[model samples]
Target: MKPGADRIELRGLKVRGYHGVFDFERRTGQDFVIDAVLELDLRPAAASDDVNDTVHYGELAERLAAVVSGEPVNLIETLAARLAEVCLADARVAAATVTVHKPQAPIPLEFADVAVVVRRTREESA
Candidate 1:
């Protein structure tokens, strides 16, 4: 693949999660928005028009949701790293970028949102 061209993006994925250092934040929970872009060879899927030719996005999202909501973490960095790891677990995915958004943060000032984003590439072997 080229340096920066092809990608498969999953955007605005909403999930309820408990991730914070504060007890109230963990107990009450909040909505988290996730965006993921996967880089891979799309030629095979493009030619075949078969689900098997590419990574199953629906399944990936489901698993990601599970990971996002399953446990409580202190930082969005941790969440982003774990999600990236999960996405790269699929053999077909060569690289991925994950973003986790926190819209309703516990800050004093007003802002649109807070988030963590990460990009990762597959290991050399397999």
Candidate 2:
């Protein structure tokens, strides 16, 4: 984010997604945690005190959830990138950072979590 840029952040968004390379993983599914940070200028909303002037987080949550729960992708990187795209869809947003966490991964050893983070800008996607 740029200096003084405003942000809207969503954390620990859990969804059961059928995304994995293994057959058992795709069949049973696993919990995916998503964090999305959107950077934008909140000055207009602050001055006007209007919801329209800012991003609606409730709507954004639904959209993000849909992406996580809908189609199945093999890699969390792809998931993160897709989520960043959704975040950058708003014209007001300048940058978005998305992290996809797979807590229950099919790893042989004990681990806290596996995740992929992606950052995207409006200009980059364009």
Instruction: Give the candidate number with the greatest TM-score.
Output: 2
**CA displacement after TM-score superposition, residue 37 of candidate 1 (Å):** 0.3
- How high is the CA lDDT of each candidate model? 0.88, 0.91
| Clash tally, candidates in order | 0, 0
Clashes by residue pair, model 2: none
Q: Name the best candidate (by lDDT).
A: 2
Candidate 2 lDDT: 0.91
TM-score, per-candidate, Cα-based: 0.93, 0.95
**Which regions in candidate 1 have their CA more than 4 angstroms from the true location?**
124-126
True-vs-predicted CA distance for residue 29, candidate 1, Å: 0.5
Write one digit per residue (lDDT tens) for candidate 2, span 4-106.
2799999999999999889998899989999999989998999999999999999999999999999999888888999999998999999999999999988
